[model samples]
Target chain A: MARTQGSHSDITGPRIREAALALFARHGYAAVSMRQIAAEVGVQAGALYNYTPDKQSLLFRLMYEHMQDLIAAYADQDQTEDAAEALRQFVGFHIRFHLQRPDEVFIAYMELRNLSSDNFAQIEALRRTYENALEAILRKGQAAGAFDIADTKIATLAVIAMLNGVMTWYRAGGRLSLDEVEQAYWDMVHRSVTA
Target chain B: MARTQGSHSDITGPRIREAALALFARHGYAAVSMRQIAAEVGVQAGALYNYTPDKQSLLFRLMYEHMQDLIAAYADQDQTEDAAEALRQFVGFHIRFHLQRPDEVFIAYMELRNLSSDNFAQIEALRRTYENALEAILRKGQAAGAFDIADTKIATLAVIAMLNGVMTWYRAGGRLSLDEVEQAYWDMVHRSVTA
Candidate 1:
């Protein structure tokens, strides 16, 4: 019975998160409720408590896992010592990774105000960890004389912000193919950072 | 008496907008109500209706006015035919204008999903007008061989997205003065568009 219950939790965990993310993305986090999430997941409110203590925990987990997954996915990519090549890879990777997770990306930016102080700090730390990955590349490139950057930290944020813009208006069947879109941005990012 | 009531509306209209903007920024539009806005404005719920028909109308009016103010302010700036100089002015103007109204900027992006479809279309048209202003600069620069851009529209969006990033993390008296910060971004923007 214990094993069966554990298995159930393992399955229900992702479903709860999926439901919470969708609802939070559609209706702002403040407007979504525990019961609503449970309803979306086809579970009772009590059963949701079994999975997460409350809605905030669920939100934190979704955001935390999104960041964790992002870091891990990027880490799994091949690393190169050449700073320009690495930065190029980053431009492509950042755009592609974020484009695939629209709801998570939306919540990550939109719901930061709703996080508890502690939760916000933890998420911010994770975000910094992800951002540092890019900042380090900018610093390495600057040290190696491959890129001309005013401030590595600002460049890092600017690059990410510019890439994140893709999610706002990009549609698969839009005027430009995804490859064309990515190439255009990569060219601009490359020029922006390099002499 | 009629003139006095008209003056009262002129004063209360702005107060109502101020209260609604603050409330919607703090709480999502879906979660905030006419009654809440009325309380925030220190008026009765029924009195709120006199100022605005409903919560949705208030939201549309706030968003409408923000876009209108943005376009009007940008239009009032010194016009220059030089593409690089014009682009620099834009980078500075976009950052400074948005930084002053954090609430409006936050709501502009975050609350788009909350706008009624008709309201959304009008706001989007206003936004496109603003974007076209930038795109035209890029096109002129490219035509004159002043800028090396892969796609003028894409470059327009990329530059604006990059500049909009300042609103996310800028604070006065931080490591960089506002001038330094703007210079850094302007350098990046200028480089990205020009050879």
Candidate 2:
């Protein structure tokens, strides 16, 4: 079907991205088509091209923006020398961030292979930067003797894994409040790294 | 292309499945076509139907068999009353199983939603059974006062989540041996749970 002209507006970009995120999360990147995403956004197939050059670019933009957002959010937090506090901030921030932007989180995790090699490397580097931030906190904690961990790198990965796993089963209206989930995860993290 | 006719040989089914598993893992389930799988297995597309009714069934079979194999392996282990030892066994088994069967593990985790509702339920039920095995160990540890967990269900989920995450980054031929990875994971799990 011919896409209506002028349908690509300021709002359409985010709308298309949002629709792509959901579809990618539900059916994965390879299975989802530009037409399906366009339909979901209530636009014509050709109009989607006005927003994204191609499906790959659309997927890349979604993942790239999500990673940038995560890095920004973590950067905005108050700097603290206290490793435990820093970790708590990281944990709390991660849970809240993923919860608030479930679509982006889904896209970032599920559509890595869909991006071109350069795009994949770009997104992966951003991810590593975020991960290294947490690792720095863990290392500091170890130095201060406030926490005991066998391996800081592995521990960082473990904590992030546990937190990211929440997206797999967490629902918006689930019985456990996000606060409770965060607390439970914090407790687990505390136990894992503490002496 | 038309599928070549082959006698209903026992090896043919496994061949088709093995080829499908590799392709699915490399390109993802939705991106892999039945014809590609047939070509990989040296058969025509129609010939694949003799083994599997459709592409979805092929995916389900791989996932289903992986779970079954996991449960069976654990079942063969000698009975042990020590919760920690049993938990260690579970972790070791899981890591080794996934590492050895990367294709199956990839499909099971990555292409779960591709299954029909009925098939999804069956896979989910098998997964719960595996999860229950871990939960039982946690419950025993809690009862013995060896583990300090606020919620066994949450703790079990957290522990499993962290353990399962090893697959995302683990390489089959990496410098770190599977035994070493298992040991590292076991150390983390032990430290996380033990009081």
Candidate 3:
């Protein structure tokens, strides 16, 4: 079949990434093949090369893009004057962003072992950038006497880990709605750091 | 080379489990093969089958035993009378237990998707049993007015999730000592739910 005239790369790129993310999330990066991914995307095995050079590139692109998206999204949020308010907003934003992309979140966290050393370092840098964003907020709160956290770095990691927990058991139509889920996590997060 | 005559099952069992755990943790369950695992254990692929029926069984047994050991260790802890004391014990116990067995903990949480439906259910039930043990403490705290948690169930998850964070980053010779890590975590955990 000939390539579509309109948005060929645009359409196929996302579909490829979507297929790879789902496949990796389910079968793991090392276990999945380009053939399986191409099949998942309804494309020929050779056709996938147009979008990604190889499977490692696909995995790296997925994780790198996820991290970049997270950092960009966090950066876009309004830096509220009140540290508590900023943290509350962060709590909601993080939970919603991750909840909507369970597959991406899972792959990002679990597939690090599969990343090459260079890719791992790059991903870790991006991750630390995101973590530092939270660390900065905790520092702001601590300076303003809004939070009594002992260690900003540890708090950032702890808070992110706590929020990451939401992805594990939370279902769309579960016992608690997303709003309630965020509220509970926010409360715990807020109190955990605040004096 | 002949097989050693000294307690063959006892000798090979732990080595097989150790090799399997490391392989499964690093490469993930679906990607790691029986041959690779046997190679890691310095045994033939056929000899490896004597200990476990298949790769699926190995994966299931690893996860199953991790959960069992968790439950057993938790049960073995001395019963503290006060809810706050109990929670502190749990925070410390959970963090220390998970940290010491990073490979097991990693496999236990990350490899759930690879388990068969039946095996997944069994693992989930064991995990729930572990979660419920913490939930019970929260309930007791709420009853005794020791904690003012919004939702005991979520609080159980949040606290454990918070403690589980330790395993992700904390190292044996990290910036903070184990005692210091436990103290900081226990403080945050205690205050997160306390009145």
Candidate 4:
């Protein structure tokens, strides 16, 4: 649909992004049309173009923003030099942060294949940067002999993937509380490196 | 296109499945259509239906077979009674098995949301049964004081998650061989629970 005059006057940037995120997360980037996203946002398809150039941009933006938000949240958390404490904090922080945004987490992992090569590389870089935060901790622990990890990079990937696993099955009123889940994960994570 | 009489003789059941798996993995379950799958398989759209009822059935069959194959392979592997040894065997088996079938593994985790409720339940049951195999090892280890874990169930998930992470970044010609990758993961998996 072509945009009528001032058709998008009522729409905000975040509202469009939110709609795009939910739709892409549900139907996937390749499957979802711009019109569907526009319908979800209650905007004309032409009006949607004002916020994002195309579906590719929307997918990249969502993934980039998710990674940036993750990096920012980790930065805002109580980061410490104590390797064990920092690792422990990362466990709780990662689980809580990811649990709150299941859709974003899902797309971040699932929709990588649909992004253009440049976009994929961009997302991977952001992911690596986020990963480096944890890898740095492992390196510190390895340096201090506090943690005995075979490969810091591989271990970093392993731990992040493990934490992400919580989002798949952990429900709010399930048998385990969020605190217990975090504590349980922290115990496994802490032991895995320390042992 | 609708099938013409005698137009379906060339296509086989395995060919239909192979096409469906590739399409679904590339474009996601919600995005790929039966027509598209038929195109991939060089068959008429109606001819595709003669093998599988619908897109949902195709998705379910792919995931079901993957899980069944995983369980069967694990059973075929040297399944020992010693908890520590069983866990070690699990880490190696999971990494190798999942690495070889990246597309199936990707769809199995990513496409679950697209399944009907009943289909979802069936797949979840299979997944839980698979997870239980590892959990049983953790439980035995816990009982025998071989593994010092707080919760066997969570440990099972965490360990599996940790191992599954390999499929995301691991490449064959990269710095590490499959042996090294499995070894690195096994080391972390062993320490994560044992420590």
> Model 1: runs farther than 4 Å from truth?
A1-10, B1-10, B33-36
Give the Cα RMSD of candidate 1. 4.1
Instruction: Give DockQ for candidates 1 onward, in order.
Output: 0.62, 0.62, 0.68, 0.64
Q: Model 1 chain A — which ten-residue stretch has the worst lDDT?
A: A1-10
B179: Cα error in model 2, Å: 3.5
What lDDT tens digits, residue by residue, belong to model 1 across residues A57-93? 9899989999999999999999999999998899899
Give residue B76's error in model 1 in angstroms. Answer: 1.8
Report the error of model 3 at residue A63, Å. 1.2
**Winning candidate number (DockQ):** 3
lDDT of every predicted structure (CA atoms): 0.88, 0.84, 0.88, 0.85
Query: Residue A146 in candidate 3 has what lDDT?
Result: 86
Interface RMSD of each: 1.4, 1.4, 1.3, 1.7
lDDT, model 4: 0.85
lDDT, candidate 4, B1-195, per-residue tens? 344556444556898899889888887877788888888766778877777777788889999999889888888887788998998888888888899999999899888888889998988998898999999899899899998898887888888888888888998899999999888888888887885
Docking band of candidate 3: medium
Ten contiguous residues with the weakest lDDT in model 4 chain B: B1-10
lDDT of 3 by residue, A64-179 (tens): 99999988998898888888888998999999998888888999999998889999999999998878877888999899888999888888888988888888889999899999
